[model samples]
Target: MASKLISGGLFAIAFLGCLVNAQLDTNQTAQNIHDPQPQTPATQSQNTQSKSHPDTQNRRSSCVVEQQNKIQCGAPGTSATVCNALNCCFDGTMCYYGKYVTLHCTKDAQMIVIVSKDATIPNLDLESVGLLSKTGNCSPVATTSAFAIYQFPVTECGTVMSEEDGVLTYENRMFSQYEVELGPRGAITRDSFFDLSIQCRYTGSTAEALLLEMNILPSPYPAVGFGILNVELRLANGQCHLKGCAEEDVAYSSYYRDSEYPITKELQDNVYVEVRMLGRTDPNLVLTLGHCWATSKSNPLSRPQWDLLINGCPYREDRYQTKLLNVGSKLMFPSHYRRFAFQMFTFVSTGAADPSKGNQVTQTADTVNPTYEKVYIHCNVAVCQPSTQYNCEPRCFRKRRDIGESKTFTSRQEDRTVSSQEIQFVALSQSV
Candidate 1:
């Protein structure tokens, strides 16, 4: 009886043990189906590639900011992205469109003379005859102090007047160029001038009338002032009068009052006038002259004096002779004096090359080699700042009447009159 009881107890214990082991096997199988262990080499590689490939795709996406994206432009709050191919540079204020063409400048004066000097009716001299008369070149080579100032009148203010249908094509006549010519002159100022004479074709046809627009890059200096822009034009009689001299209007002159940027005289036709640009001084003491623009004044010369005659020459020769002309002119013109035309905006080149070479810009074009060009500084004695003396009438701009050296004439209208021709510049006469 005792043996039988022992055998039954042992069988019951064995049965219970078998049931527990089966349950353990079932849980292990379930875990295997739901969750796998560590991944294999191939699986890990595939997972990594899956994670990285989309980032590569996202990086190349045009709409999204990518690593090597082409267009990086967009307004602060807006999504207007401009590509690099387009000349849309932010002025820090706004995205403006600009043309991307390389300018090849050479420091050789002979080359500049060839460039700044307008091509005379090379073959047919019809000006010696009557009826058809055209403008002449305004490049005058003069040595002043350590700098050799080359005043090349880029365009005639008269062309601005005759720009009918807005088709003034002076680009071919004067492409924007500045090169420094090294000679005895130690350091030349960047102020320059452009002369406007009659453009006559010997063909003698009225259809030969040509008009064009001229453009200059921003000034090199941080600031520029339109101090003295002397326009010498010839009337039908060939007598050159400083036609656009600032004619003062007491009411208009007072509209904008600034000690640094004062209008010496009102804008007028047929008389050279002293115009002031909106003046602002930077922390570095650099002054800038904003471009003159349109205003509703009684005078026709209300346009910011365009077709600029001279680049720099302080009206007050005593006060600002040492200062250099900042390259770019300001864009905002006073409403009162917007009709005036400008030729060049004087600038300083912050580069390793010569200061005389205005802005030693590199050429990106394949056809032309990289070169440098000389820049100049312009000064005027007439009305920059009124003379302290009481009785001395403002002297007209008079150039040294040297016969061989080219002189800057004031007018296209006074072609035949000798009295209209007052040599405006006197080189080596005054020590600046």
Candidate 2:
């Protein structure tokens, strides 16, 4: 009986042990399904690198900021995320200003007023304000969520200029200082308007600064004969005043403002030339342009030449296309300057196959070996004392004998020949 009881107890113990083993196996399987596999050393390194890769790429690429020149855009200790939300620049440690509403003067003698989109003026229409350009165009050049930029010439936009104590100030009074109602429309208060003022103080005289702004380099004339008979030849644009001196002929485009020699021009474009005498102050002395011609080479005597002016007049064939502008007669200039303009042309090849075609060459894609033409212009200038016998004025259609018969013009005294720098003519289809 004792043996049988012992055997039953052993069977029960075995059953319990089997049950515990099954429960352990089930728990292990569940853990394996829910948890990830353990990473190796290399796998862990690769995973870490992948997680950090996007942070480097997501950073702003052009966040260049100088430590000394940084303008604060946020309060101290501002978080990077918050600074970025403000559209301001952040340098990992601090936030700095980006773009804001401002007014400044440009080096080109112009006023630039930028109004940020964030700027607010109560009860005012920004576009319909009284601000305007020289031609009364008040439209902004560009508008974006960031800012609206308005440009105005210094002499325009209803700007008032005043000079005092060697300082020149240009002011745009958008709002009246004395009267609030006279301010720009929709202004609720005197401080609710926009205005701009810029002052230019020169270390030298104001005239020097003005000349520099105008890009007029006045060079002294070299003495030539008994009296100073120096002449200057300048190339100008169409905006140049017809009767003004070189100072008033400021180049509005950079193409004509280049001081480099051998100015380039397009074929058939009008080329304005100004010839002025310097150094002589005699009121009676008058300037006379005897002849003007162009040649392919630097030497005035080179072959393959063209005549523009002959015997104090435009060539007969190009009379309509060439014009001699009267200068120094108006109060704009002293009586020592003259101007002329002619259509730019290139000399056609004399060796063309057909003479009847008149040697007119046109640019085409099939043409081989395109070349630029170098042209040099020469002018014969004379400064003479006018008397009752000879006034030294140009007479276009008068007979040649009549000029030669004048006793005062017998000896060509104070005659100085001047030539312009080389000018290159490019084909109409080619880029300069």
Candidate 3:
């Protein structure tokens, strides 16, 4: 009876242990199926990020990288709005920092910080600052047309240049001759005879004149838009070699680059190039604070074009008028002495009477100054020069008056030496 009882107890104990094991397994299975735990935010973000960037397992490692400055990575094609929100860039794989580019300010004091389009720097926030430019793409402009050496241009409306042997030239000639001189101190000076008016004046003619029509005068010259009134190569010293030059001849020089144009003057001096809009009462002028591009037309693939930093911000040349400033000046480009130069265009609001506003707009259009296409350009062209073999000095091999043989056979005189003081200018005419 004792043996039987012990056997029974052992069997009961084994049965109870089996029941406990089965219950534990059933509870674990139910927990897994019905009582599911919520996923973490980190895990969800990781999974979403993994979809875009396969190598990146989560957001912590790639999307929000901790760099020196809060750099948001992005691609060139990504829109500016989306790039700003996440403080991240769309560098192919959603927000990723690529590289950093320094934006130098031309001002001595307040500077700017701008990022490139390569999804590195955050969209520049200048709203708090008193800056005019908005956050925009900082990509390099594509080359439309580019050439080397210099040549005289053909029958363009104003001025057109074609490549020639040694120099680039204009088809028609003007009273002004442009001379660009490189000073010993790396300062560049360009001299031009600026004709400030549309009408020709009578400046007493000499006997050597063949054309008698040269002397003419109009009392109140017919109103015309501003021609290329003045062009100065803005140098380190805002000094004009020409006496009685405009006050803005040397306004300011800048190395600073903003989203639009980096500030150059300490006090934000307004250098105005005024144009006359027949209907408008206020002054029609372009504000100049020269800002040149560091990237030049050194490569065929990278020539300059109408961009944000240029004088005419929205340079579409549509109904809206825009005028160009910072031409031929250091304010327009990095070096004033590139083999290639700025081919510029600007349209200024005529400040014209808005016909849509039901105002009687009296527009007197002139042939000399039509609607603005490309009013002017600041170019670094090859200076025209005489060949080495050419001889200008009057010589009979320094003849001794033909051995005193009563010589009226004279060597006609010709001026060979050119001076820096005399100003030179050229007008370029063009087509579509």
Best by TM-score: 2
**Model 1 alpha-carbon miss at residue 26, Å:** 99
Could you give candidate 2's per-residue lDDT for residues 209-270 as a string of tens digits? 11010000101111122245778777765344556545334431222444433343543456
Q: Best candidate, lDDT-wise? A: 2
How far out, in Å, is residue 99 in model 1?
A: 32
What lDDT tens digits, residue by residue, belong to model 3 across residues 240-277? 45778764444333311123121121101222222111
Rank order (by lDDT, best first): 2, 3, 1
The 10-residue segment of model 2 with minimum total lDDT is 13-22
lDDT for model 1, on a 0 to 1 scale? Answer: 0.20
**Which regions of candidate 3 fall more than 4 Å away from where they truly are?**
1-82, 86-88, 97-412, 416-432
Displacement of residue 114 (Cα, Å) in model 2 is 45
lDDT of 1 by residue, 67-91 (tens): 2211112223221232122212334
- TM-score against truth, every candidate: 0.16, 0.40, 0.14
